[model samples]
Target: MIRIAISAALLASAAPVLAETHSIEPGDGAQERLQEALILAEPGDEIVLAAGRYHITDGLSLDVDGVTVRGAGMDGTVLDFTGQQGAGEGLLVTSDNVTLRDFAVENPKGDGIKSKGADNIVYHRIRVTWTRGPHEENGAYAIYPVESTGVLVDGVKVTGASDAGIYVGQSSKITVRNSIAEANVAGIEIENSRDALVEHNIATRNTGGILIFDLPNLPVMGGGNVIVRNNLVVANDTPNFAPPGNIVAGVRRGTGIMVMANDNVLVEGNLLSGNPTAPIMVIAYVQPYDDERYNPLPREVVVGENTIEDGGYDPQLDGADMLKAAFGGELPPIMWDGLGSLYVSGDTPGWTLGLTEQGKGLGDAQPAPLAAPAPAADFDETGIGAPAELDERLG
Candidate 1:
């Protein structure tokens, strides 16, 4: 009896120690209630979800500071955006220090999950798909984060996202590793971001595999996008159907390693092969042909020590035709080692992987001063396109 009393006392003491955890069932407007859960969740709360389908139309939003949401498992839990009333964005998270792991989101009207203005967020072992398969208007991204920082996205599998799979735009201090992306408009694009480490990512069978771009037309400048050691980035054949009678530029078509207006960027220790066109590209977006830019002034870009196993351009073909076929007509032909029996487009002038004088020019080996990296505090993850000052990472 005394021993039983002691056990009861111990159990009572431990009861308060248990952290609060909540569960939301399938039919409970799981999408709407997700917001409530975030409101109620404390720093370290876990929100466990049951194994069932949650149709998200309005979508799940998060502003909570720090929380962890885990599904039963990737296959064990499914968040279906199918047949939802309006456009579906399965989950949109805009919080800091959050984690959403081990779940499946499908057929989101927009991007499956867009984590904007976020920091230190992790989407681990998550799967995104479109059950209806690859539709041009299906959704933009499987997992898209903008202006985020200190993020780690791993163990993600994305299929049939319309725009891109796993797009990180304007983020800093990020890492995207051990993920697989396939059958999307573009696979794994890191745009206008800085100090990012991308490794061990498999981008295959998509329109563009493993792209890093600094879209120059925008008012805000974009630079410092990096691509690091990774596995296969091969043949990106998938392309959205063209609008009737309209032709889009191949400079924007199926490719591997697309970078423009990016500096101090690194592409090393990677295997890029079997692209229908150039397996690796460093192309100039339609910049001015005159005045102060090279073959005029100087801009910086770096492409180093990567194994180009097979495939590149066929410039004898009409550049327009080649682009429709997905050859980014960025760089001119090259000196073929003759290992693959592929003719080098060396006949075409002014484009080389490194600096050039006429087209796609950064000029000969003159170096841009190595700028210092910025601290995390100055780079805000909560705001969109914060001012790019020298003190910040974009600086």
Candidate 2:
């Protein structure tokens, strides 16, 4: 019996493994080969692309859960979709526990890399770009993950997106760190997402550096508990070329960081400079809409311990005309729209906006004019207001 047990243990130890690896090289019919590999892939499989340019006309989709798609390196492996015939995104991921890393995706007709309804998804050391610079025809988002949970985007670089270079929308527990975004409408945007942490990022030469917005009419609403910290948000004066009807189209050029209609957001420990518009803007979503389901006011926002320099001059008049008229053509480092109703205690409830006094060019929020102009009847025509009123007291 002891001899039989020893032999059985040895046989089990020698059993073959189930993990498989597939590699695709650059050549004719590369897309077909990749598609075949994806179709054949199972859970716990790895697919690798060789270090060369794979010119693909159709978008790629991976629906296998727990699969890893890897490339030689972000600089060496390129997926060029300039001649894409697909009408949608470059890469679509719908599987849970998937990992995509170490590759570059360029010039897709739509979004660069998008993951929908995926959980525990990670995108690391990846680069996505539009080579033609910012244009309305460029893709909407570079790295977009919507309706995802436990999403992580780390050490990635994105550029030249018409809407947002790195956008995480309708997601939860997202972490975006050690990334760079440039020359996009809204460089890095967290829209309608909750429990997001955006840190250690450099956002420059975009229309708006980092945006936290909660707009009406989406799968998710009322984003909260976001933290934007330890980031360098600078310059960001690129012209806004987003196609009309997109929420980011309203982003003012030269703005560094904007928090609009979100709740419980913390902006801290960031270096903001060279943004001609307001370096930090906290505004309510005053768009006229009949949907009472959407909360248009930001609540319990705290802006603390940030370094501000050389901002709030030469505003983007197209979006900041009201700010120009109100502040004599010069904005402040920290601006808040005082547009909510006063509580019975003579102070706004959770609607109070807080900013620390440790930064330069920080100004107290001025009271809104009594009988201020009502927002445009069209929801899209309403502009985000300039500084109105803030407490300047940090809690």
Candidate 3:
């Protein structure tokens, strides 16, 4: 009997720990309390932030896998980093299978919430804002996820990011939907990522609404297989406010949707209006690149049928007056650099720079009306978007 009891006790001790909730409220020493809760959380545990504004001094980090960080609501629970003295971001997560939901981060000094190498992460109903709006000194990216796979960012709102409002880089199997990005340099950006679905997002009043780029010399290369559809990209006329040395600083204002150096990209079913530049732009990477693995030209890009209105009426390009006159008072809705293979699914009007090679100037451009073939067939959408299981967490 004694031996049996000892064995039963050992078995109970070896069982998995029951998940617990750590509740934190905003008040004096909230910074320490919040940090401690995050640090002490175990896998399959939750840290709940109560409804109030948490005045944080330094960045908060979470390295525990399978942890959920919940807050009252995006508007009810605020993490104000206005007085932040240190750290490169407001919150950093380096673990996998983590869920962050219903929180607001305001005035982060650098990037707002960055998840690096955190796979299977979900960011839901979160808001990040720069109160002053559209300044070069604002945070570089509001919601940033890099070097990870299986990312889902849904129902999030971001504003006034100097670089990008919602940025996913070096990741795969990503989905960004039901989000609003406004007053940012690049509203929504997918950089050096593969198999991404960007849909049902509102991108407005930014320098560039949606940018899909594949740049050289990154840890991940060959961004491709992206689907951008059902988005409202309008009036992206905010001046370029990115830091002078950033690549996005060169992005012309009023660009609705720009795809550069990516392969197998599909742009369709979007509502684009009031973008003074081309509503849809497909271009090659013009900068000189040393990476042999990088393909600087866009390939197999298909611009399907989309609702475009009042675009290219006040282009921000050089010799806009001449181009307008040449195109009968307004340029086409679509603009291409004419360096790679592009197909328009329908009869959407377009124009091209008609450059023979990358790194060519506009002076070398033989500007002409876009003459591209229709897509051979429907774009293959297999294996795109975030994993379906990420939505289960929201329930």
In order, candidate lDDTs are: 0.61, 0.78, 0.95
lDDT-based ranking: 3, 2, 1
lDDT of 2 by residue, 1-395 (tens): 24345436555797643667888899999999887777667677899999999999999999988888899888889999999997599999999888888999999999999999988788888999899888899999999999987788888899999999999999888888889999999999999998888999999999999999998888799887788889999888997999989888878888888888887777778999988877877777745656668887766666666888854787764445665566555565665665432111111111112332212121443334222232222222121211112111001
Best candidate according to TM-score: 3
Q: What's model 3's lDDT at 119?
A: 100
Error (Å) of candidate 3 at residue 125 is 0.3
The candidate, 1 or 3, that scores higher on lDDT is 3
Name the TM-score of candidate 3: 0.96
Kindly list the per-residue Cα lDDT of model 3 for residues 1-395, writing each as its tens digit: 25345436655788775687889999999999889878777678899999999999999999989999999999999999999999999999999999999999999999999999999999999999999999999999999999999999999999999999999999999999999999999999999999999999999999999999999999899999999999999999998999998889989999999999999999999999988988999999988879888899999999999999876998988899999999999999999999999999878999999999899878888899999999998999999999999999985
State the displacement of the C-alpha of residue 183, model 2, in Å, after optimal TM-score superposition: 0.4
List pairs with backbone clashes in candidate 2: none
Model 2: CA > 4 A from native: 1-17, 318-329, 340-395
Ranking by TM-score: 3, 2, 1
User: How many clashes does each candidate structure show, in the order listed?
Assistant: 6, 0, 0
* Cα lDDT over the full model 2: 0.78
Instruction: Extract clashing residue pairs from model 3.
Output: none
Candidate 1 local Cα displacement, residue 280, angstroms: 0.7
lDDT measured at residue 122 in model 2 versus the true structure, 0 to 100: 84
